[model samples]
Target: MPTPIPANARNPLRTFRFRIRMNTSAAGQYVAGVRTVSGLSVHVSPFEVWEGGNNLHRYAQPHKVNWEPIVMEQGLALDDTLERWALAVLEFARTGKAPGEAVKRDVFIDLWDGFAHPTEVPAPGPEARIRSFYVHNAWVSKYHALPKLDAMAGEVALLSLELTHEGWEPVPKPPASKPASPA
Candidate 1:
């Protein structure tokens, strides 16, 4: 018989308990206070192949792969990293000069185990991290600087950025270290 999973591991990781890290600079800073994240997905197109003798059946094979644009929304804050990045891309388009490394960045989304209270999600340490998605070669495609301003509304001001990325993959877990032998 197969071994059963432990009780503690049965629960799914909560979506709210996560962190977004953008490779904005060589220092590698984390984008703080992100309210929402979406569009972490990929689609593979399939091509149909039919053998000359086998008219009865057709085989479908994977072809081109496409990655969806990731959208992130956050309450407007003092930090201007998102704005600056978007402006850089705009400048590139205006001047016809390549933005080079300044516009493109790798984004990391880390999902943490939500064992704590909803109001008290702790910062994920290495062990607390359940999984991480690595978004490669992402550049800002759209920037919504301000939402529909309404003085009568009670909602917070939100700024959103959409990023087009080449692809994304799950970050691989590190190898386990071996215990030292008795001397």
Candidate 2:
């Protein structure tokens, strides 16, 4: 069975290391790190601000934000899938909150069998760009049979500080923000 084409191939979401700077005079550059997608990725974590704190003076709280595009890039239906991922993430960034789990529903999708095929990429070490990917094994098996451990999810070993606050509750209500005007 051949792979399915991305229903949304025309325009995929743009995932990047985005930094929202809270500028300060001279050079006190404060920033908000975030992880966002095109709004279809389900079960995605939401956004939260990094309030200040420290641990025994060894490290101070990261006042700025740190972000990444969370979904894996297994290509194929890459465009459509990424769009969903982007939109979901963006919603979180603006609201500084996660969409309630009750509002999320998990659906499976097809992706490359990289986890099952080591030669496809490489022995992902602690230095690889992507850590892992989830394959709808139902789809994988329907297309190609698995010879070994029938696994659906594959993870890479690389480490990254993704999503500044994956588990921080927003204030009673986030202060309303105004749209940015042209500089």
Candidate 3:
């Protein structure tokens, strides 16, 4: 069995916040019809997230992803990119940054093709419709620039994704990681 985290270990989730969003990609759909979900105003410790789940705080992991449904239609060709982009927007809303890594669709397919359908990460639920892999906001933002989220597609307009890491937690520094990065 894996060693358990000490009772006093600091929680990273408590120091950061989570933000998610939904969008469609029908030429002019990615920007339009998209909705933003703001996070609670307070930080949430991993203990609080796992709540009843055992060994929660002991494991430094991302909380369960509450994925949204795919809004595009069948053969929408845009569905795959749409969902992935929507998630990116939502992530930006929570982290103030978007995926900035310069990558090609081929690379993404290799990582998540088996998980979803066309390209997103594995959906957390059955009704979920995504196949593209999503990276941490910080990681993605460092290489990928978020597209304009409020506008419709057709035109390649870049939208500034709102980011907020509230309610998330960061393990408090114990004189070691002290002065921890503000989540």
Candidate 4:
């Protein structure tokens, strides 16, 4: 038989939906019109820190943190802003010369509730700001704008970008602002 559920076990603040935003200081601005982003992938490199003295079992521990490249997918549009950005990174990767400057940037993911009137992250109310995850020092690792046409030519074009980053951490909540005193 299954055990009965507890009333206090459920959490009202739990969220399940989110929106993604990518910003790059290296590009001097954030990439606009991004449709979707491959969610965060983090790994902790496991290694043995302590050795056993003729013992059958050895203790192991996590040493380094590694983050996988995030893939940003978007519907190909008329604008070539993202294309140019990707090309710039490619130029640097291919040759020493870059068509334009390339810089590392941070990627942020904001959680949201579907019940909200306007479905967007960073909403005015604190309820909309469920949780924020951010990755630091990220750059484009690969870009694909190739089209596969085989009776699917009528389908919308899409662009896939792989962003390699160092590591990610949860964004801390902002402190409450104090009211100003009368002059």
Quick one: best TM-score, which candidate?
Answer: 1
In candidate 3, stretches whose alpha carbon ends up further than 4 angstroms from where it belongs are 1-121, 126-155, 164-167, 170-183
Q: How accurate is candidate 4 locally (lDDT)?
A: 0.66
Report the lDDT tens digits of candidate 3 across residue range 17-133: 111322222221222222332222343234233345565455355554432221211122323444354466556667777565211111111011132122233343323222222
Per-model TM-score on C-alpha atoms: 0.81, 0.18, 0.17, 0.69
Please write out the lDDT profile of model 1 over residues 1-183, one tens digit for every residue.
Answer: 999976545244467878788876775777777889999988999999999999999999999998989998877884666777888888887897866538788988988777644666655456667788999999889999999999999998888999999999999756645789999
Q: Lowest summed-lDDT stretch of 10 residues in model 3?
A: 104-113
**Clash pairs for candidate 4:** 26-103
Residue 126 error, candidate 3, Å: 9.3
- In order of lDDT, best first, we have 1, 4, 3, 2
Arrange candidates, best TM-score first. 1, 4, 2, 3
3 or 4, greater by TM-score: 4
lDDT at 121 for candidate 4? 38
lDDT tens readout by residue for model 2, 1-183: 999866533211223422221211333231222232222222434344443674333433435433322332222221233233334455665686764321122222111112332224323232222222221101000111112333574732221211221221111322446789999
lDDT of 1: 0.81
Residue 46 displacement (Å), model 4: 1.9
Worst 10 residues of 1 by lDDT: 5-14
TM-score of 4: 0.69
179: Cα error in model 1, Å:
11
Q: Model 2 compared with the native: what TM-score? A: 0.18
Better of 1 and 3 by TM-score: 1
lDDT of each: 0.81, 0.28, 0.31, 0.66
